[model samples]
Target: MSFLLRFIAECLFTVYSVSFLLYHRRNFLMKQNHLIFFLISAVINWSFSATWGLAISSHYGAPALLLIVLLELKGLYQMNPMQLLFESGYFVAVLYWGRGIVLPVFALILNQSVHWVRHNRFYYPVAWILSLCMILVYNMLFRHVIAPKAKVETFYRSKEQIRFVAIFQVCLLGYLLFINLGRYYGVDLPWYKISHIISCIICFAAQGLLVNRGIRNSSLLEYELHTELLQQQLERNLRHYKAYQKYAESFRAFKHDYNHMMTSVKSLLSAGEYQKAINLLDTIHETRHKQVPVQHSYSNNNLLDSILQDTANRCEEQSTQFSANVYLPAGHNISDIDIVRMFTNLINNAAEACAKVTSDSERFIAITSRFISHNGWLQIKTANSFHGKVLIRNGIPESTKPNRDFHGLGLSIIDETATKLGGIMVIDVDQKEMVFKTTLLLPVNIQQWNKKDRLPVRGG
Candidate 1:
């Protein structure tokens, strides 16, 4: 009976731990077949604990189990190895603390409660109610209250924060193990057990408070950084808008003077002063070309057109040739902010790559978009010339900038935005031609596009 109870308990704990871990990592695992691997790992973990007993299994069998879980996570998520290790270690710490401390304390409480109640018939029902209440509280606090404040991605990415939590859990586990050892040695000190359990509870509460505070601080820092970036983008947009306004004003002035210039040219021609007429015609042509530069209309979406024009202007300033043929129509499901983010990152990366080419003629950036009417998919492609080798890790090109942690987030931001919009991004590099290209495909409403939405392609 004891063996059966132990085996059942181990199985339940394994399933619970795996479920908790999977729930915490749902964002990363949603698109993958992670359930089967986790289920298999849980079964193996239960088998190990049932066969070898909790004592040997936790100490000796844990490393093997950790290795298996890490391998499964790596194969599925393609996360950094160091991050994987930290995640796996954190899981082990949580599992160890739950099994070693919380479960034992609950069992002790229940055992003591049965003696006080005298009527054993009500025990199972009471236990069931208590279990349900605990689960409800746990979910309400962790899922609803805490999760929004401390997003899983943000929490996991901060190595130091996770490391601190893991260490605290380990310390609590050690303290509980020591208490358990005293009980094993025939120490009949129930008060001592209760006191230690109380201490552990307080410690756990303190740890939770610390973690919450840390997460809040991290969130505040991220918000501030994001706000700064938005301010910078707003300033750039204002500059672009002002430049466009000036260009429009100059074009209007040219239009107002057109009739007078034409009349003057006709008069000069009628008088038969052939050389003077030719000079006057040449002067008018120069004035028209200088004042009314060709205005580009790359897309039906005003915001997208502005972004393209801004990028074009930046590229021109850097002596990099820029070309674009975009046709994004209005009234699409994609938000304007998301479109801005995706296109801005894409063009900026292309321009940066173009800047690396030594030969002026070879430096070029090209962007185009096509709507596949049949599939309701919009494909955007950017191609540019680059001079050096591009190192790609886990499908993302590593940033060549000195401050890699801060500078390399553009691609990730674009990729994340694409993913949020039910899209996929692909990158290709041609070593022979020294060209790098990025392609993004996003789902859009077919009704949003029409023949009038088409725009002529232009190159500089």
Candidate 2:
């Protein structure tokens, strides 16, 4: 009965530890039908422990650990063997360290000496209870405090990390198996205990190194994000200043033309040529309107307005025909920087494409945005004409222009923005029509739409 109880307790502890580590690594096994997975895990754990006990002379947990590593390859975790092994080994190491500290307290509570604790019938059961409590506390601390501030991907994303960890774990496992086999053979060497302690310290040091590296990576990632945001803000402000200047110029031109128009109108009226006066007024109105530059309003969202205005100004300078029909609903919840990044990249790519066209009459860019899917999604589309071939790989366009190092980031930037905003971007090219189009869709919560202020500007 004692042996049976110990076996059951060991199996339970191993499953709990593996599952906890997997959850922290974002495997989230318990997300779907917890009871079913738990049952399956229990069966596997029992079989694993039984197989080790029946054949392997109780080699502390080497065979059992190896079995778990093999099983995880086919498990629902979606991790490679080395990654799974590292996670499992780390969990085991942490639990062993915790047990080394807490099991003595248990021994004292049970009125037994520390040496007697290991040989006692209740040793495994007590260890199981203590390990479970420790695992729970560590899981909470890892998820809430440590993980939020660290880059977990920095450790797992590199193949070098996997190879290093795998090699270290294999060495540790080999040493452990050797020591346990020596004990099974009644070869109680003094160095066995010393080697075990040294190995524990090494494992602790390795884990500490991993944690430090992850923190450093997280800091670097945050710094890069901050720098990118500052650049975007600077660009947005510059565009706003330019748009204001253009508006002022257009207002001044209209004001100057107003007096001349009044004088012409009065003279025509005095001649009593009613039809001619009407015709002259119409002609004057058309001429004044043409003389003043048209400032187009694209959206009620001010951020979108600024970006569109900037793009329109660029098109005008290039003598390209530009048309925009954009309506961003009131109370749009997206951040200004993300809006700037996404639209800026899209429009910049379009402008560059249209500028290369030799025929000025054929060069054109069009932009449109609307709330689609019953306001649950925002769809933005841009179309422009191009003269050269567009190279696309993995749905990403490669830069065809000179200075490839400096020019290929436009679409990548847009792709990153779309991913951040829970959106997708599609790029399409019509070879015969020489038209390149991009469509972006983002999930959004929009309250209302206001399209009355939209100005459709067409450049001659």
Candidate 3:
């Protein structure tokens, strides 16, 4: 009966662990059905747990079982193998060490000997409760706090990060395996207990240090990404400025020749050549309309005007139906560079999505920005048409193009800019309509926004 109870408890723990893993990487696209997931998880977990109990010592069974479970979950979640390994290894370490810390401390407080507790009739229930508590607490902390900011893919995406994580896991596994070896050899009680406590502390401190280092590395990468964005923005603005300068020069030359052309038209009219004068007038009007400087401003702010105008020109070049209804007042607390980053990314993404539409008539992007001064809110809404499957991970769309080196940064920039402005962005897609829409809401009034709250314009 005791053996059966232990087996059941172990099996349940396996289910709990794998379920937590699936939930941890929930943002990854999952194609498996819920029933199938449960069935496969249970069958594999039960088979492994049973096999370990029958053929392997409990000291080596748990980690071996969990490692296999992690690999199995990789297929179900479509997660990068190294990421799954790193995450699963860390999770198991936490589980094992957590119980190591909790159980001993708990036993000491109750004045219960470890041997007596293990052999006691209430052992299964007490152990199960403790295990459940630790797993629950770990899951909550990881899901609510760590998972949100983890950037899980980054662990495997960067070679350096992967190498570090691999080394960390190896060290962790060695420590756990060493403890098991000590148990297998029947090491002296007090010494093993002391070593266990020390190992737990070392494990926790090592994890904390590595996590801090990873965060610092992530920040450095973000700075690099931001720098790249700013350089790209500058190049775009420079090209637009050059185009406007040429247009200005052409307009001045047209003005210089305007009087001469008008005099010729007047002379032709005076000579009773009505048709010839009419033709000349038509040509002059067409030239003025077609050859004049492009209007890039839809709002009162010059920075926004430049961005929208540039976006409009690109859309026109691609035969996309682009429309803008921006109404930012002259003097608000919004950062100019932040605004540039925001709209530049938004419009560029929309234009790119629209560009994929094979039918010219179907390619359209509409951008609207409105400010409610009384409410101290700014709203930007952009909608575009896209074809093909859209891949979104952690709420940001992934690049569909073959050359992804430079493509996927736009939406991330928009997200970062919105966050810096103390605003929220909402994205929604209508699959049937093939439309993607995103809304960014910000508090723009000086009363609601502090100048000091503005993020640094320097990319670094």
Candidate 4:
């Protein structure tokens, strides 16, 4: 094919890649701006790629592809230099082992330099100078002036080269995923081939969307977390506000009683009946306990407190037994929303599950939470009593009956939260009891992992 035709084909594929990224809305995952930054990113990648085509061989497209991928990864995982280096190293290693895969690997390596320059701004000239030097060095090493280009192409295009490269690519990705497997769903295995293909597709889409959306993952995650924190702050403040309201109401009632008592006391003094006014004050003091329900000692934020209290109240109203023991640390690293959602979803689920029982004794729900270590690893287990067949024995809950869109997402949400916190959740059923347990690396464990690698560092 003519050089012009080949260039056009590359352009087509590049455009396709960018378009796919937009459609997938990878940037939308973090709620990013949709115009300026994304346009700048796209123009930069393609412009540099076009420049490479003009200055170097048209084959420089490989590096362009790699450059885009690195930029995309930066957007996806919020990787720093060291982390980028590690990921690039892993990616390139996969390429290197495949022999003919050197072109793509070299492309990826070139991308590391390009991406660094793109972000650092001041490093642009350095990237170009280094890139030029690399091109010259590669030209000399291959002795392209002496050896025919056909021979090099022949070596790379061999059947064994293709197969080995494919194998290496597969293995590289599979290993990265394997490392993260326990961080996701329970102990269930992932289908590597399917996952890799899907992930690649998603990555392709993510890159383009990132360009269009002007999204940087780290910035976006920070923003999201900030928003959630604000929401919690508002909710906490709202709780305090309500407590103040209750106090205000109690104060007003006391003021009215005082005026009425003063008048009554004078009348009583005239009648010489002093005991009645004293009895009135005593009566208000006696009813105070009933007016204000007992507050749990574990702080107002103890997630299960409200749920348990509500449950107990309902049980009293219906004459049923409801017992609960929730022991969880306060102001821990876990987010309030996650704990709130988990407690609300799980307990409500259990409550509804047990409500179907006809007999009052059998209708009870027992909940307990404790920190347990299996193999000396910290985990929290919550078990509830239920009747009838257990629907989900494995951590994964089965599909809710048709048209119930929200039911299945509860457990799925639980699984997702557990995974995000780098924890595992399991659901097991025995006789009439359904137990859901999730073990998160105590916040300390996360700190330890962060210590293993410094923040904002990417590996090349």
Q: The CA-based lDDT of model 2 is what?
A: 0.63
Report residue 58 deviation for candidate 1 (angstroms): 6.4
Candidate 1, residues 44-151, lDDT tens digits: the string is 666765554333213344566557667766755656555566556544544443333343354466655312322233442343234333433444465556555336
Candidate 3 Cα outliers beyond 4 Å, as residue runs? 1-178, 189-202, 263-279, 289-293, 330-332, 372-374, 391-394, 398-413, 446-460
lDDT of 3 by residue, 91-181 (tens): 5666666656554454555566444454565563456556656666765765565534455434334435655765686578566656746
Report the C-alpha lDDT of model 4 over 1-460, residue by residue, as the tens digit: 3445435534643453355345324211322454554566567656754554322212333344445655654564333333333333333322222212222233344554222323343333333334334333432442333223323222222223323333444354444335324323442223432343355444333323322232233234334544654564456456645755776787667667768766876787778676876776576666555454444332234344544555555565655566665544332356767775565556556666666656676565555544332222335554555556655522444443463333444554566567566665667666534333333333323322221321221111
- Tens digits of per-residue lDDT, candidate 2, 231-274, equal 86578668787767876887788778777877877887898777
List candidate 4 segments past 4 Å from native: 1-244, 251-285, 290-320, 323-331, 371-379, 432-460
In model 2, the Cα lDDT at residue 441 comes to 84
Query: Between which residue pairs do clashes occur in model 2?
Result: none
lDDT of 4 at 180: 29
Clashing residue pair totals per candidate (backbone < 3 A) = 0, 0, 1, 21
TM-score of 2: 0.58
The C-alpha lDDT values of all candidates are 0.64, 0.63, 0.66, 0.44
**Cα lDDT for residue 216, model 2?**
59
Model 1 TM-score?
A: 0.77
Error of 3 at 181 (Å): 5.0
Q: TM-score of predicted model 3? A: 0.61
Best by TM-score: 1
**Which 10 successive residues of model 3 have the least lDDT summed?**
451-460
